[model samples]
Target: MKLVTYLLLGVKKIGVIHNSGNVIDITDIVNTDDMNVLIEQYAAVEHLLKKICVDSDARGLPLADVHLMAPIPAIRRNIFCVGKNYYAHAQEFGNSGFDSSAAAGNVPAYPIIFSKPSTSVCGPGATVDSTLDPCNTIDYEAELAVVLGKKGRVSDSDDPMTYVFGYTLVNDLTSRQLQKRHSQWLLGKGIDGFCPMGPVLVTADEFGVPANQKIRCTVNGEPRQEAAISDLIFDIPTLIKTIGQNITLLPGDIIATGTPAGVGLGFTPPRYLAIGDKVTVSMAEIGELTNTII
Candidate 1:
């Protein structure tokens, strides 16, 4: 089922997108005002949510009528991100001359991890602010993000999929200038509205294994990034194992699996995002996330 958090008549509600393309408000059935609360109780409520999705009498609102919010607009902590997980992207980034470390080589034996503050999260169709200082060069990275369902430390013997809750798309927006100046990623990647996510969150069962899915990004309807999830140098299981070894994975924790090669900075003269530019990040089965620069 495709789950969503949306606003209708100025009231935010939890909904499930039916196969009929209508959004069924499960707020009454779930009895919760917060999506995070519902997600935390997902295992207990999955059956009921599925039943509501098929109930003909269940009231539903046209998808176009409601404003969709990020699956989890305000997360409890920073968003875990993998940098240069795609081999091609690593080569491009290494050659970009922005990172002294990237100059060493394209592929790293270990995952290059970073975090984006929770404040950066924004929903599809939202407008991103681009007028801030130190953000003259904005870029987009389309990625397939995983949402955790249970609290556990991933072990070599454990099946990582068992810990997954769902999948969503994330446009890992970046400020190249800040990234270079600071010599770190926080200020460059954690700007408010930098992470535009969601249209729907597909449950793990429906999303299946996190491999070989088409991930792409477009700017103003022009294709910029395109690659398969199979290209990930450090796959989901490895990421979970690596992160879980240090920090416990909790329900609703998001891990962006990194982006493919066509980021604006990869170009010779860099095609950075500008005011009025629209970026659309799409992952097969998970749906698309589009945001515009204001």
Candidate 2:
């Protein structure tokens, strides 16, 4: 099922995209306006929600009539991110002189992790601001994000898919200058409107194992990044087990599995984003997320 959070008639509601491509508003049956609440109660209510979708009398609106929002419009905590998980991306980043490790031509034995504050979360088609002081060098990272279904520390022996509820696309926007100057990624990657996610969240069963999916990003209709998820060095299972060892993965928590090669910084002189530039990140089975620089 493709789940979504949308705005209709000025009220934000939770919905599911029906087989016909229309949206079935399930808020009334779900008895809440919060997607988090729905997610928390998903297992218990999954059947009922599915029934609502097939009911002949159920009312549904054309997808074009509603405005889409991030699957989890407001997260309970920071977004977990994996960096340099892709071999080629790691090499490119290291060679670009921006990597703190400066380990050019070497892939890490483990996943490089980071976090993006909840404030950075935005939805598809949102405008990303680029006028902040010293933030002139903005870049994009197209990634496939995993949404946790329950809270737990996944062990290496455990099935990581058991904890995953769904998958979505995320554009991990960054300020290259701030990244290098601050010597950390927080200020550079956690800026407001930096994480543009969603169109819909495809459940685990629907998306299957994310590895081997095609991930790509385009700026103003020009392709910039492309790679297969199979290129990930650590993969999803390793990332969950590694991070879960310390932090508890909660329902609604997002884990962005990092980007591929061909980022702006990988170019000869580099090509940063400017105002009015449009970026679209696409992952097969999930969908595409597009945003414009303001």
Candidate 3:
């Protein structure tokens, strides 16, 4: 099932996107308005969601009437991001001369994890603030983000997949100059309004296995990136095991799997984003997350 947080008539609400192409207002179905709360109570919440009152003949609110926000607008902590998880993207960054991770041959032996503060997240249709970077070398990376359901450290015998809550798409917008200068990703990639996520968060059961799903990115109608989720150098289970080995992952935690090739930097001259440029990150099950550079 696809769940969403939206603003309708100045009030924030939680909605279920029905197959009818309308959003069912389910905000009152539960005691809390927080998306994280629902995730924290996922098993119970899923049970209740199975019995929603809306039926086929009854249409709910038209999608155009409500403004969608990030599934969890105010995330509790920093979002974990993996860099160069795709061999092709690793090759591109290796060739671009901006790979600060500076692994032996562009690809690191282990996962390169970084974090983006909650303040950086913005909802779909929001304008990305380009002026934040003085060098103006904004680039877009389309990523399939994982939402964690349970809080625990993944052990050897544990199956990481069971802990997954669902999935969502996020645009990992970056400032090339800041990344190259700082040597680490935080400042360059975590700027406010850089992460444009949402429209809907598909539950794991509804999303099925992460494999076979393709992440495609386009800039102003031109196709820039395309790759299957299975193409990642490190898959979901490995990522979870890598991070959860030490730090205890909590419910509502977000992990961006990483981007594929065809980023602007992959170009010869570099096709950095300009003010007013449109970027749309799309996947098969999840809908497109489109944003404009301002």
**Higher-scoring candidate on lDDT, 1 or 3:** 3
Question: Candidate 1 regions off by >4 Å?
Answer: 102-104
Regions of model 2 farther than 4 Å from truth: 56-59, 102-105
Per-residue lDDT tens digits for candidate 3, residues 16-82, read 8877778888778766778999889768767667555246665778889899999989899999999
Which digits, one per residue and each the tens of the lDDT, describe model 1 over residues 1-294?
899998899998889988678999888878986777788888788998888788888778888999999988878888899998998999899888887454345588888888999999999999999985365899999999998888978877888777788899999999998888888888889998899989789998888767868898999999999998888999998888889877888888999999999999999899999889999998779888999998
Pairs of residues clashing in candidate 1: none
Give the CA lDDT, 0 to 100, for residue 167 in model 1. 90
TM-score, per-candidate, Cα-based: 0.96, 0.96, 0.97
**Which TM-score value belongs to model 2?**
0.96
Say which candidate scores most in TM-score: 3
lDDT (Cα, tens digit) per residue for candidate 2, span 214-267: 999999999999999888888888888888877888998899999999999999
**Model 3 shows how many backbone clashes?**
0
Q: RMSD for all candidates, in order, please.
A: 1.4, 1.5, 1.2
